[model samples]
Target chain A: MREFQLIEKIFKPLTKGCDAAQCLADDAAKISLKKNEELVISKDVMVENVHFLSDDGGFKIASKLLRVNLSDLAASGATPLYYMLGFSKTKDCDEKFLREFARGLKSVQDEFDLCLIGGDTVRSQEKFFSVTIFGKVKKWQILSRNQAKEGDLIFVSGTIGDAFIGFTKACESMKYFSQRHFFPTPRIELGKQLLAKKLSKCAIDISDGLLADLRHICHASKLDAEVFLTKIPFSIHAQKILKQVQDGGRVCSHPELVSGSKFTTLDLLSHGDDYELIFAVNPKNRKKILHLAKSLKLDLTCIGEFKKSTQKKFEVVLRNEKNQKIKIKKFGYEHF
Target chain B: MREFQLIEKIFKPLTKGCDAAQCLADDAAKISLKKNEELVISKDVMVENVHFLSDDGGFKIASKLLRVNLSDLAASGATPLYYMLGFSKTKDCDEKFLREFARGLKSVQDEFDLCLIGGDTVRSQEKFFSVTIFGKVKKWQILSRNQAKEGDLIFVSGTIGDAFIGFTKACESMKYFSQRHFFPTPRIELGKQLLAKKLSKCAIDISDGLLADLRHICHASKLDAEVFLTKIPFSIHAQKILKQVQDGGRVCSHPELVSGSKFTTLDLLSHGDDYELIFAVNPKNRKKILHLAKSLKLDLTCIGEFKKSTQKKFEVVLRNEKNQKIKIKKFGYEHF
Candidate 1:
């Protein structure tokens, strides 16, 4: 279908909220506040070779790019209302390529029902995809990274490591998991529900990974988290990846045992695009929130708890095969 | 001065109509409007090699990209409020390159006091820039090209072809006249005054050139134009460009002789980043509007009048040495 047609048919249904969020089909979208909502805006950059491959399928890259931005929206338990896109044109680009690019934009925008209010397209040697998403939260519903506090329960949605596993397979030319490395979906509904019911106090999406992204909250909130390594979510295919890493001359342990330093396989488990919601919920609302999510088709898991700052007191906690204490060196991924 | 410090200092005084704009410095900007304004958002893309050469100088390219967006805002007579930028990183691109780029951004934003809201940065092989400007105008003051009426007078600021001359010189390595091409101010005060007085009924920015842009207004208004070429205020340097083209090969019996079939010269007038204002003013307001602009230290010239139709008669009236009208071929800038 044509881009406009696709936007109308597939995407227009998603423009929701108070009168502030006008229908998304207009050339320009306007949001007029009915009550109290703070507009949250975030922009993310993904470049070819840096964020994706030039040879990567355009649709996948475009959708994943949108997902990454939407993941940011979920961080605040906000509804993504609008987005602007900036695409760098390449020499090989032409009208047809742009048409397809627009179509792909329509698809993801439609999936989220986001209004493609405005953006820029320009030519460059390498492609850069920058999508800036806008969302809104009632002042009370806003969950900032700095709002995490001690005694708050840390929770993550669904599975982790799938994205990293997919990335590893893509790097190794293992055809089976290439799709996982692309076309990641952001947990938009869950985020909306979280805000709607006041379940999350502070949250962020696992775009960088559980460790790296969680560190953002911890660092900003000045709180520390002790995640039960045994409670770490693993993909159904995680065992296969752990086995592959073990075959690559890395000492391994039973992942369920959570014992010993697992630095070698940490890369496979720590760094990749995971658009799942990572939220901190009040301990009192845990059961109610879990039940609410179940009715809303969202799976929830509590993985850890927050504590006072750990910078002054460093400790490594692990469990042996017999469930006794042992030392585990690495926690997660680092961008630097 | 440091980039952010320069922005913070210089932009402080020029802030316009910001009482309602959600000014988010170093984070994200937001605008919450009550009524009578439909947010107009548009984006344009620029890339090295495709939009400019390596020799274009980084600062000029950066300013030019921003100027184009401001021009878009200027056309709609929208209050140029906030802008978002997207950039690609290359191996050769260091913090130094970025500091200059950010300087250019801050300069433009400060000059117009256009808030730098948010943007994305990524690594790439060739430099690319995409800027999206957001502005708001009253529902009635939202001047669009399609709203011009027959009998409307087409007015533009300053002269048209200077940008083309500066462009040609820059292409030919000529030193002089390059400054005008580098920074064509977005006629902010002129646009706002026009909007406030509701003098400009319909408008489009003259990024394409007077002829082509006028053509667009004529098409959108469902009318044609009877342009008086002699009335146009040609810059002294444009006279030099006209002299060269005429003295070289474009000799004809008519003073308003035609050459350069693609309107490349006029295309430079109309084509890329000239931030001149093109508007259709009601015939009754012509003299008073001109007086008002003069009082504001700005120049406005009426070059053409709208016609009923050009569908059956595409006539180009070139003035002979005696000022008698003679038939000539028609041409203007091309947009794809």
Candidate 2:
């Protein structure tokens, strides 16, 4: 199919019920903001092999691309509204691939109540996708990373390290962790509730792993973070894998997955792709925050707290079960 | 440099003077709109060796990327505001290349009163760039392709096919047409004046050649366009090349540049990359539009008129200097 037909047949339906899109027929899309509302925008780019595996299907890639950007809005306590997708298709992207990709986008849009606005598509040797998502929040309720107070308690939603485990397992053709790796929950409702109740003012999504992302908050707020390794929440599967690796049990034949190698708990904390949110809350709202998480059926763990930075530099201190500080060599993934 | 350091040292400065950008430190950018103001957004993706040459400098590529998207806003009669860039860098994009790219972005942002909001940068094999530009237009002043009326005089800004000539010549290491191809002047002021003075209500940018883009207006408006070949404006350089080629004189040693080859006036009309605005003006407002163009020191020519479609399908009829009908086998470029 040609470019115009591909858009009309595969992507145009994603803009249904969105008057601002103009059926993707105009030179630009028009968006009107209501009074007292502010628009929040974020963009994320994913390249084949670098961000996602080359063997992954188009559906998984498309869904992950949108969800990652949505996670950013969730971090900012914003409601998903609209998104524009920039797709560079490789030679392997046939009509079937585009249809599946559109299906994935449709599913996410339906779930999040978001609309596709406008974007550009081109042919390229490398397949990559960039999604710029728009969301809305109250004018004064924007949640930022620099708003964390020195005494604020650090909270993380849902269990961590599942995505990292999934990534490693997916490389071995293991479907055990594929769902967690391919599909991520953006936590939009949690973000909205946190803003509506004025529970938190600082938050960030764990895209570059927990340690690296929390360091961002520390740097922006000019504070230090004290995280308890034992307090960090992990799913049952992650716990099993941790125990097996610690006991020198062979989990897989992959070089990185060898018994007691780099797949330790510390390494998991440094690996990314988890879409859960890490937020800062006042100590006074500790009980209320837990109750809020319970009501939403999500596990909210208090694994750390913010402290005044002595050297005026961002620092994250990880403590073991015995209260001994642990040394970390690498924080997380770096694109450059 | 790591991703965070690269962003802080290189891309962060581009967000200066824009409070909504939050110094590019936040997860997402915030934008607040005034009453009766609508946001106009357009995204364009350019891939190396496809939309641009592989040997093109980072500065030229970056500037062209911004200018093309700005041209879309100009076509919609919107004022430039902010933009988000997605840069996928190849292995060869060293620090020098990044600095040059940032410098280009700074130049365009300063000239157009635009700000860098937020975006993502990643590693890729094929260097590509996606720019999503945001503009603002009064709620009811947006010019649309579907709003053209029958008998409306089709107007084009500046000269056409100069960029096409530049593209062909640049391939042969000729710098004569480089400026026109690399640095296109988006008609932002002309668009604003057209909207402010209500000179036209239908317009589109000439990126996909004059005939192809005109066909877009015709298709969207459900009308047919009749363009006069003699009325189309051409630059002196383009005119000279056309005469040389038509008179059976060799213009260059390149195969395509040989006398009586594909480098004809009609071929120029079929090639793209010209960032000029094409609008439809009411016959009564013709004199006013001419005056507005003169005030802006821009060339505006009446090339054709929109008419009711005879077969209910989009159609564009071309006429030569001798008033003979011309046949077009192809419209313009298509990605797929």
By TM-score, who's the top model here?
2
Candidate number achieving the greatest DockQ relative to the actual structure: 2
TM-score of chain A of each: 0.79, 0.95
Question: What DockQ results for candidate 1?
Answer: 0.30
Each prediction's fraction of true contacts recovered: 0.38, 0.89
Residue B140, candidate 2: how far off, in angstroms? 2.1
* C-alpha positional error of residue A3 in candidate 2 after TM-score superposition, expressed in Å: 0.4
Q: Listing every candidate in turn, what is its Cα RMSD in Å to the true structure after a full C-alpha superposition?
A: 7.0, 2.2
Docking class of 2: high
TM-score per candidate, chains pooled: 0.80, 0.97
Q: State in Å the error of residue A319, model 1.
A: 8.8
Give the least accurate 10-residue stretch of model 1 chain A, judged by summed lDDT: A18-27
Interface RMSD of 2: 0.9
- Candidate 1 lDDT, B1-336, residue by residue in tens: 332333344333323435322232322344455455656666677777666665666677788888877877777777777776665555666555556666677688778767666555555676776666777777656666777787888787877766666654422444444666777777767777787887875777876456666666765567777766577777776666676665563322211224342233434334444568778889999887878777877778887777787573423233434666644333444322
Q: What is the TM-score (0 to 1) of candidate 2?
A: 0.97
